[model samples]
Target: ERPNNSRFSSCSVGNISAVLDAVRDGRKRDCLKEDAGAFCGNKIVEVGEECDCG
Candidate 1:
């Protein structure tokens, strides 16, 4: 089970696909610049990402 503070609280046994679809939609709306992919591991939360602990 997920903790109350989890960002994926909407996830459940039968509705996981819906949750993934929502996430994909959100990502589409929040699309980042082409260069954003190269900075994913720099340990910084950039425009298109929620967190980067690397």
Candidate 2:
């Protein structure tokens, strides 16, 4: 059950590969932590990516 004042929801990934594999297969998650391999997002950006409209 969810409380009326609650402002968020949650879920779980049955398998680690579920999330990783989805990202590899071109699916984007709600959020991603910044790292050296990726500066802005999990998706690798190419030329002109800076001007992308979200």
Candidate 3:
């Protein structure tokens, strides 16, 4: 159950994929991340990395 002051969401890969595809096409709205990617983020990045808006 969510607390009165906080909210939680469930993972929906379909939604995530749609957003990712839209970003690739420059058609989706995005949010900015306050911090850079985590230390492990780069290790997982591909040979040609792309930008992340959130």
Compared with the true structure, what per-residue lDDT tens digits does model 3 show for residues 1-54?
A: 337435324456677777788888889665434765444444455445564223
lDDT tens readout by residue for model 2, 1-54: 337545433444345557778877878665456653434453556564764322
Model 3 CA deviation exceeding 4 Å by range: 1-11, 32-54
- TM-score against native, each model: 0.28, 0.28, 0.35
| Ordered list by lDDT, greatest first | 1, 3, 2
Model 3, residue 14: distance off in Å is: 0.4
Residue pairs of candidate 1 with colliding backbone atoms: none
Provide the overall lDDT of each model, using Cα atoms, as 2-decimal numbers: 0.63, 0.54, 0.57
Best by TM-score: 3
Give the alpha carbon lDDT tens digit for every residue of 18-52 in model 1. 55676787844443346635466777798878988
The TM-score between candidate 1 and the true structure equals: 0.28
Tell me the lDDT of candidate 2.
0.54
**Residue-level error in angstroms, candidate 1, position 4:** 38
